[model samples]
Target: MRTSSSALFGLGLVMAVDRLVFQPDRPISDVQQTLLGIVRRVART
Candidate 1:
């Protein structure tokens, strides 16, 4: 099977975050929202 770079990056980020911080029992969608918020905040500066 094959996967795009973004998919791989997301998987790596999830694993790294789970290991380094609290394991999120919430849906993955929440993380997507948080990431989007961060990007938007950066862009406004």
Candidate 2:
């Protein structure tokens, strides 16, 4: 249960960072884009 909660917290944190830092006008590195894509896929599932 604790692990699950921590995982959820981490996901939420990632999502928050995605929205705050990855704006349309801003450019991101390839690694950052890949990480964001992975996070988005996981979020959809």
Candidate 3:
């Protein structure tokens, strides 16, 4: 449980950094977008 939670947190952190700093104006990578999608889907559940 902790491992999964930590992984989600880490993925979220990476997504946040990618959105805020790495690709603010530009498009994000497929990997990042996929991560974001997964996060969104998880949030809905």
Off by over 4 Å in 1: 1-16, 19-21
| lDDT (Cα, tens digit) per residue for candidate 3, span 1-45 | 797789898987877787788778756576577887997897787
lDDT per residue as tens, model 1, 1-45: 145456556765875587457855756677667666765675576
TM-score of each: 0.50, 0.49, 0.53
Error of 3 at 39 (Å): 4.8
Candidate 3 residue-wise lDDT at 18: 76
* Model 1 worst lDDT window (10 residues): 1-10
- lDDT, residue 21, model 1: 78
- Ranked by lDDT, the better of candidates 2 and 3 is 3
RMSD in angstroms, candidate 2? 6.7
Question: Against the true structure, candidate 1 has what lDDT?
Answer: 0.64
- Candidate 3 displacement at residue 45 in angstroms: 14
Which stretches of model 2 miss by more than 4 angstroms?
Answer: 24-45
